[model samples]
Target: MDTDTIDGQPRVVATDAALAFIDEIRKDYPDILFHQSGGCCDGSSPMCYPADDYIVGDRDVKLGEIGGVPVYISASQFEVWRHTQLIIDVVPGRGGMFSLDNGRERRFLTRSRMFDGGEACAIPLVKRG
Candidate 1:
């Protein structure tokens, strides 16, 4: 898939490995989706899901096909991910795999170092008082 950019943020593109992984995971869970939100750093990170929950403040994007599996982006953080691609690869000591920026080598992962599944995974990351 080609890369995309909107406003000043990067878009999410699926990598070869990511596509393959998505395919394997989709066999049982076809309703796959992606989501993002503000992180400790400059912006938010991409996440994978099996379904949608209509969460407010979240943006969702359709990533088309990566390894013959369908992908979706969050409706809340669509702006921040305007031009970034989600690269799939194994991270050092990170287990299975993780997502990274296509243009840069930056990787995004949950505090638990595991896939969060969906919106429920994003709640804890939200900055609290």
Candidate 2:
């Protein structure tokens, strides 16, 4: 499910704060992954989990890597956001209780900006594998 290209502008990227936060958390939990959860109590945010802990099913699509952490979205959610570049950022809040960043007063978020025609054509669409 890794659809990365050397010259391609990634479909996803992480902010500096998000990267630092991930680094700090990774100290205790080395292998981590993120799943884009649908809108619910978590508000359509990305949920972090230990690698291979949250099973990646057939309906999930791999977006790209952010801070060396792989990110994915449910098929349904991807359909709605496929045209944009996903930006993972951190902001002050109580995150999903089960997510590693929950108690840190900062949570992983999914921010996005629609891609222009050229960028859209350049980004790769990753299907479930």
Candidate 3:
């Protein structure tokens, strides 16, 4: 769907630097997806995985798009973080073990800002699909 479908209030967006990094990685893995890990192994971070390697399930919530890629979070996590807009950025560091960003020395991070009334109104609460 085109971005307009979300009323132009993107729930997830990426910085120019992060998009550049993602574009570079696209050379190796054409199809990629992002999942915000709820903690534990990944410690509540945004993790990138090849489409074929990861599966979106009933317990996941599609927050929105980031650099044309779908971004998801566990249903439980969404319940706690649904009020803020996510800014996906890249930082220098090792990525989570199972994430595609690992070994690149650049990791995906989520920097969020609470939505204003307009944005909050435009953004719907993530429901299970």
Off by over 4 Å in 2: 1-7, 121-129
Q: Please report how far candidate 1 places residue 21 from its true position, in Å.
A: 0.8
Give a tens-digit lDDT track for model 2, residues 20-124.
Answer: 999999998999999888866778788999996889978878888888888888887887887777889999998897888889888988888888867666655
Which stretches of candidate 1 lie above 4 Å from their native place? 1-10, 39-44, 52-129
lDDT score for residue 23 of model 3:
90
Q: Where's the lowest-lDDT run of ten residues in candidate 2?
A: 1-10
As for candidate 3, its clashing pairs are none
Q: What is the TM-score of each candidate against the true structure?
A: 0.41, 0.86, 0.86
**Candidate models: Cα lDDT each:** 0.41, 0.82, 0.81
Better of 1 and 2 by lDDT: 2
User: Cα deviation in Å at residue 34, candidate 2?
Assistant: 0.3
lDDT of 2 at 3: 40
Backbone atom clashes (below 3 Å) for every candidate: 22, 0, 0
Q: Number of the top candidate by lDDT?
A: 2
Give the lDDT of residue 38 in candidate 3.
79
